[model samples]
Target: MAKELDLIEEFRDLSLVCEVTPRSVKLGMLKLTNSFLEKVKECQKRDRKLSEKLVLIDEGKEDDF
Candidate 1:
């Protein structure tokens, strides 16, 4: 799961490497940027949930899941 999150982060960084010029290019870059950021947000949310579950498990609260 950590690895998956890392890959998503890398993709988010990659999406930031565009060079916008014309209007169309700018629009496309905006689309790509938004897409990558949404993906990052989703991954981060999942990671947070997993970490919270791990903490619960450590405290012997596995029934909460």
Candidate 2:
């Protein structure tokens, strides 16, 4: 029937839209993940430097006593 054909067309269009929507969302999530990872790396580097400084300070204090 013509009505069945119309319903099928509508379903196909909706399916295509649903598939494309997730791909765009996935791309956006990838970008956000990369940005977050970069920030984490920078924080880790700063933390490592601070830890090294603390160790040096502790060593100097032990020498004084």
Candidate 3:
């Protein structure tokens, strides 16, 4: 909307208080960062689980050696 764009243009140069609910920048950043961290941790857990399965498979193959 034009109103939204106007607001963005208005605040494109102001840096006043930094801890008000109206200043959603920090809250949005925190939410996004937390979401990213959760995804990274989930990916790492999946990777480690896959690696463990691969190691188990490799051990089985070695037992057949």
- Kindly list the per-residue Cα lDDT of model 2 for residues 9-65, writing each as its tens digit: 665655432222422321121222488889988887789766677677788853331
Per-model TM-score, in order, reads 0.26, 0.25, 0.24
* Model 3: residue 30 alpha-carbon error in angstroms: 12
Model 1, which residues run further than 4 Å from truth?
Answer: 1-46, 63-65
**Which candidate achieves the best lDDT against the true structure?**
1
Clashing pairs in 3: none
TM-score comparison, 1 vs 3, better candidate: 1
- lDDT for model 2, please: 0.55
What's the true lDDT of residue 42 in model 2? 89
Misplaced by over 4 Å in model 3 are 1-33, 48-65
Give candidates' CA RMSD values in order: 15.7, 11.9, 10.3
lDDT of 3: 0.56
Question: Can you tell me which runs of candidate 2 are displaced by over 4 Å?
Answer: 1-33, 48-65
| Ranked candidates, highest lDDT first | 1, 3, 2
Query: What lDDT score is found at residue 37 in candidate 1?
Result: 85
Residue 10 error for model 1, in Å?
Answer: 31
